[model samples]
Target chain A: MTTSTFSERGAAAVGSAAAAAVGDGARHLIEKRAAAVDAYPAMDAMRDRVREIRLHTLAHLDAYLADFADSVEAAGGHVFFAADADEANAYILGVAGEAGAELVVKSKSMVTEEIELNGALEAGGLTIVETDLGEFIVQLSGDRPSHIVAPVLHWTKEQVGHLFADQLGVPYADEPTELNQIARTHLRRIFLRADMGISGVNFAAASTGTIAIVTNEGNGRLTTTAPRVHVAVMGMERVVPTVEDLGVMLEVLGRSATGQSLTTYTNLITGPRRPDDDDGPDEFHVVIVDNGRTAVLGDEVSEVLACIRCGACLNICPVYRTVGGHAYGDVYPGPVGSVLSPILFGFEGREELPYACTLCGACLEVCPARIDLPSLLVNLRERVAQEGTAFSWLDRPLDAYEFAATHPTMWTASIDGASLAGRANRGGWFKRLPWRGKTWTSVRNLPAPAVTSFRRWWKKHHGA
Target chain B: MAAHTVSVLDATEGPIVVPSGSCAAMMIDHYADLLSDDDALAAAARRVAGRVREFTQFVVDDLGLDGLEADATGPITFHPSCHGLRHLGLRGYGERVLDHVGVERRPLEAAEECCGFGGLFAVEMPEISGALMETKIGHVEATGAETLVGYDMSCLMHLAGGMRRRGTDVEVRHIAEIIAGEDEA
Candidate 1:
């Protein structure tokens, strides 16, 4: 089986050749996040309060789900519960059918990406375009988003220059201003003509049936207002009990996301366009998609669903900083991806994703909702290790180590054996290995297990 | 794991010290949970965990970096492992040791980052591990320091391994090894 994650192409992107660039990019983003937190000393207190709020909400999630749906219906908006991706896509397509929509403009929404909504609409013979600039860039490049907040951060502007020249047939422009102007000119035309707009809900308040969407660009506001029909797709967990809870979540969202005090736009849409409203969509629909989140609700690791999607975890994750997102082989990447993907999908194809991290707990530190990512990762690994297929080879050391650790006699012998092995290498390390340890030794040296066990030394000296 | 905890309980009394922070974290933070189902084992774990300390913490608190002699003279960089700084609350201890010992603790670029020796993770995702190591090592060289000290051995082991494979002369040692007056290169 393929044990290593570094395929030929992935090796080049995150390997030594580009490691510096990757590290710098990650450091830059995390520093911005840190500065925002540093600027607001009370961020930790706010983080805890919101975490408690989410903890309470998630505990009564079954009740709240019904409450939310009822409130949405009462506010003159339609609420559809979709159980899986196909179901969600089918429901949204049916809504498009009922509305007789020709073109759909989408604000940047990860859940829509999660359900592959654009493809479903396109297959049903409707044109769709992503209105977020970063989303627009990845769309044109035919690339899945490499990051949650900044989708195309993996590609340099020079590469985008080439992509635009080749794909858009526009004059190559490397400057941010020029490229933005070019995109604005192109998407602005589409925004005006779109019959339906689809957006992702950052947070939904159950009490008033208000949907909150955050954006750095004006596109989200325009997408909801200009289109005649508006459909918002949200992962089922993206709801809070009231508007006040949305305010506290918003406090952490922008600061944790891009270090902005608040995003350029935080659209709090209450129902569709009202009769008194001058400019807005006439029909509003909320698609609360389960897509496997309901299954995660009562599990031991259920707290993972409390994620605010601010992506603070990704910015500080060492594995994400090193390998980049595409290597994760999942919709979400980094520490959160490792936990969320295996649970949502299954443990079969994505077994290695949970093992991707060093379990550093960096993600937990920056998390706005305070998800204990490292603990969840270890628990996931423990579950994986429970499988017999895991013990065949890769985890042999882990299994052996567990046995040796518990068995004092065998552990002592192994220590003595390592002591003997250390004598052969004057440098005091094993330069190569005789077994599958080549996975480790091929790139670096293994310190010989301490020649004399610490217990043995303590007994010899201190008479324990 | 239960039997191991019993053995540890039989052997230790108070103030058990581990050289590596990751080991200390497992003992201090995880053992109780690992033995949670059994009340007796869980209580025993909590007792043992309360006494557990990383080497830096032991030296600074119990031994009190008050009178320790300064040993290493050259410029030194400190690699703060993820487990040590984040999990076990290990920061000021390393600085206190370096300060009292009169060693020059040069700040590392990305000093709080992981060196990517995640036990079995190095084997499972070797490319990502190696790439992270490359970034950390590049910063170590940029510091122009002759040696690197860390609170955890695993991180140093990974750094030392990468340095050996790359044939770089930068040396790696645990903070205990540094304070104990060992000259390694």
Candidate 2:
């Protein structure tokens, strides 16, 4: 079994070498994003438009889903509503079986990652290849994706060189151009030989039955068209009402994800190959995976559904930059994951994930969807506090604190008593502390309380 | 607890001056939500929240003070605590005060980033918190400023602790403390 990244040993390994790389990468993305937003005068207005469209679609999701399904079917494509991962995987597997597919190529899809679709297909005795360059490296090395946009961000080029040489039996090349060429040469063969392709839907337009797949490497286009059978797995919340709404979302998504005015390829697939079309999939199937999104929609954090998977939150999250993504131990990492994970996947085992944030509000500022991430984190913390499961140690101490705070005498006396104690210590600093406070003193010395309590000073000076 | 705080704040006749930026944020941003179940209490919380102001914010905006002329120790860099900077919109209050004083203010790189002193978070997840603190301190060191100042004491204490442990002699002070020009207590 893989060791938990939250384990003491696992956490200690983070924040040193990884901090530099991740911090630099995040800084680079943020700088570019700032420049892009600065250049586009209507960027903020477009963000508002995208947010309204998403919230509107979510409010009437049933109608939109029905409309999307009908439109897809009308255009000679099949749509299956999967209630959970099991149903989604089963439907996709059935499609592959009916098509007599042995090889499958997949584009970059976080929703597919959420469903663990690749493992399910591989388990069914089909060879699967990740066509996106970052995803391909992650697939070849058997490593989890460390970032949303840049999946293998934590992997250095030297490491990729080693991975390629060992896994692909090719000469080790550390330069980015050489590495890109190697991956392109390798994935080209898979694309030609693959019988089925699975891709993620970035934004599925309900009005026209069109699904937009945004990518910089053009791999999404290949994955959708190269194979005879194409399957698109989308989180149910990915749907928007109209093609115009899709365009508005696309505008923010590209600028927010990687600072590009527009990605190199934005493939809008309406249906399967028509008789008039030259090259496209012979058949098209869309698996709209609800998984836990509908449940989340009824909850307080329904606003998170408006997210277009831009990865802007991760790029600006200070904690994400410091500790890296695997520390989150979820399919989605960074700010969005912290709020969405515990709520979607029960908070029993991974309760600490929500508390991982500093509530810095950086994610809120950069989020293209304008999701209030810090407030959501605090909301989850309130839940954790009420449950008293994740932070059971704080329950009694907080109870005492609440009691003292409620009582004026106890509050004053405690402050005065702490002040007296502080006056006894030299340098007014405690290098070591007892019990639970040692976690703090273990890193930095704590300042002692003031020699005179503020209340006492006020009374002595003003006699009020 | 929120109800009790709201009642106390409601009884107050004057503007509520909060020395800590985070506490001011808790009142202004969260108190109403915390008491949302009771319409009267929620309204009272909002009233009190409107009156709440951080120390430097009160000094600059409410008092209409441009600057305080005082003898500062050395080259000073400011750290914008997250709550004061983002929640309360106290971004320029302290900086304007420092500028008025004619002190040498070195610009902090990534000044808006958090110092990782998130109350219980500092103790709960010290590994990650310490990592963030370390990165922030590294930025502080890069500025080569002798004194680091911010409006929030909690952030100052957290960064000061990390600076102490790292053996950086840089003094940590609240913006008010620097304005007051008080010696170390």
Candidate 3:
């Protein structure tokens, strides 16, 4: 197929999948999510539980992660701690090389995405297939995930219908069930013929060394069981102290994510095919990726690690609703993405991401784990400014303003000058403004500053 | 001193009187929190949950600003900053307020989103932050709105800097200031 044809088909497939995933009320998905979540009586209970679990886990992350590694090793699985994406990808590719793997079937793993694993594996001449329905659509489209939980949320149904017909050799159909069935059929064959299974861990239990994978479809289970070797890629933050904490997290994950009581499938795989087991993989490996998360730990923004990938912030975000995830232009999106993307990718390409929020605090309000999203976004923005990344033109004036505000003499003189100008422009607002202030008046009216500045009014009233 | 007895009006449909914009935003956000209690709070919360309109919404809906005034003859554009657009869901509320005040509402390109002030976000991510604000200023300049009105003061302040740096003729005012007819010199 031509490159353009492929892109068109991919775009169409993703659009249809998103429509299916989002269901109806596409115009007002955020409002609908608010209403649906508002009506759910169990949401509050789940949020409380999830908050407690995350707090406890983050407090003892080091101990739990070490124990998890120990348990996995004891269960006949090897654990690798990769400090960054390059190291993680190199290690995974090295493993694939050792195994002499050619064809790999994978489940949805954001950690792998973070490391850009497919590119590395593909470079090694390995044919990789993404089995998860959403991941499959993204792979076919060659698009990055717009959401944490729902990857293809940007597309409409008609788009997906067109994609499936062109790429999968199926007739155009937008109905969710038909499209899902089509994907399932295509990926089933890939799973049965795969040499290795790669998946992301939702929660790693330290007590039992079990990796939990939650999904609505049964793709995750198949990806693990059908392949001879199962490789689980996880961020270091994915571990919980025990299965009890995992249970609480799972409860919150389902409710806060999609308002479901439970995901259709929740698989806990402890190791490869056991000696007496009827069906499972023969070899198991766990890759723990630090990827800037260690730097985030012990910081004021460490509270971000508590995220369970629920995508609650995406559903409720006003900005995301309008521009969608691509506007942020990162692997993550919405309120959480605004804070995390800059920290991970550095503030170069994603400088606009932090400023995209209204600081309305909606993300913090709905976060099941109670992450202080607005504060973190603010903190990250401050860091970016302090690093002198802000445009010089704006920065100089802001610095000058800050300096003047801190100095009583300069501040008073400036206020007096502004007040005089306000009086001169009184009875009619200034059609033109001075300096960068013109940017504001250029679009809307500058209320000609107050004829009497607020400071002046306060001084008169309070005898300052 | 006049005792301003602003009635803490309870929306029989949403929630009770919520004073602050952030607090009202919070109410719509944590609607579940408002409903987790007894029937009284639940009913009250539901009534005010989605019903907590912004100051602009109240002005346009209750005061009927459009009916009171004819056409406002001036170059007027609006900035729908984060609080008004994202938190308060007041996309066109400012226009409705301005239209009622008899002001000429000029169409501004990319006027519906944030100006990147974001309270502390401007200080935090200053470069990207200023870049966003500059984008907003460019759109504002393109509109040639002699007056730029929004619901939040913080955004106006940030935009004020961009305007001053570029030496544009745009002015910034709060929606409340305009609606209360306090914009008159």
- Which candidate tops lDDT? 2
Per-residue accuracy of model 2 over B69-149 as CA lDDT, tens digit each = 666858999998989888887778788888888789999988998888888888877877887898889999999999998
Q: Report the C-alpha lDDT of model 2 over A234-285, residue by residue, as the tens digit.
A: 9999999999999999889989988999999999999999999989999999
DockQ of 2: 0.66
Candidate 1 on A93-126: residue-level lDDT in tens? 8988998999899999999888888888899999
Docking class of 3: incorrect
TM-score of each: 0.94, 0.97, 0.69
Give the Å error, residue A210, model 2: 0.6
DockQ for candidate 1, C-alpha atoms: 0.60
Residue A275 CA error for candidate 2 (Å)?
0.8
lDDT (0 to 1) per candidate:
0.82, 0.87, 0.71
Scoring the B chain of model 1 against the true B chain gives a TM-score of 0.92
DockQ per candidate, 2 decimals: 0.60, 0.66, 0.08
